[model samples]
Target: MAKSVNQATQAKAKADAVGQARALAPEVPARIGSTPATKFRGNPEIFGRLVEDHDKHRALLAMIEATAPNDPARKALFEEFVRDVHGHAAAEEQALWSTVMRNPETTEFARHAVGDHHKLDKLMADAAARDITSPGWLTHFATLKDEYLEHILEEETEQFLEAEKVLSEADQRYMRKVFERRKKAEKAAAVIEKKIALKPVA
Candidate 1:
């Protein structure tokens, strides 16, 4: 009787240990932090989605800018869109694109993105510095719009789809989440910017 009790206790202990180990083990690759480079790297498909969403934002900006700046509501909306665009681009540059550039597989795509980034940087700076109502503002905005769409098309057709081949299913899912989160963040930033623009400056 004593021996049997000891055996049962030992078996229970072993089962509990196994359960604990399993609990501590990493889950499937679908989760955001499952891999290192995935969490920090740019997946072109995801970036393309980001661009699509951004284009919608640009459209909104153009609409609001077309209105009188004294129209508090339109002005606010425009400011919000600008803030969102700035935040999204800044985050991608800092986290995704920067890391991807280091990998040999992504080198050429990264270089192209970097060059596109330079053009975008100038466009953004020029737009931000100008009087939103200036005659040249629309032309500049239109030029930026064309370049933006072209870059996005290149990423979608060539870079992003190509990169997908190199990633695991889990990493791919993570990329989806990252892109979704970025979209949400940009939208939120736009709202906040609009709110701020509504307030009378002290």
Candidate 2:
């Protein structure tokens, strides 16, 4: 409940800051730590849905960076981001990237993305060890942000395009179902892990 209130307050503060900045310059990107608005939708299509998730991840990362480490909001937001990253990576690997890998034309790109997920999982494990408010945690978070940004940019620029070119409408419809199913399973597992981790030591 408190976390929800904090999030709402923080979002309002961010919006106000952007509004003020726009009133001043009217030309620059809205404000510090703001991400671009998403152009994707809720329907779990291969490209658009993935892009939507990426946009939300970017927004959550930005919010996490903007937050003070001591704030409860920071920890809450970071946990959400972690769950999202894990679920999206797992599902994309099982569904979208696997399909892309089958096409000789996109095999290399698919492999690169899968390799990133492996490296990122390792990084996430390390980040999970640090105190939310500690300097080490912030460093880990920043590094994760950098790597995530690069991966998403690559996907936006090249990977999804390749998949679209190689995949038919029917193929995407099937892949979308698989992606949604896999994402849900992974996300549920993430929630369970979080719950178990938070339980008092026996």
Best by lDDT: 2
Q: Write the per-residue lDDT of candidate 2 for residues 1-202, one digit (tens) a residue.
A: 0012244444554454335324432332322354433222233356655766676676666667766667777777667677878899999998888878988998998999899887666666666666778755777678877888888878866677666778776777777788889998898788412121232221
| Candidate 2: residue 111 lDDT (0-100) | 96
Residue pairs with clashing backbones, model 2 = none
Each model's backbone clash number: 1, 0
Clash count (model 1, backbone only): 1
Q: Estimate each model's TM-score.
A: 0.55, 0.73
Q: Global CA lDDT of candidate 2, please?
A: 0.66
Model 1 regions lying over 4 Å from their true place:
1-52, 61-78, 93-99, 178-202
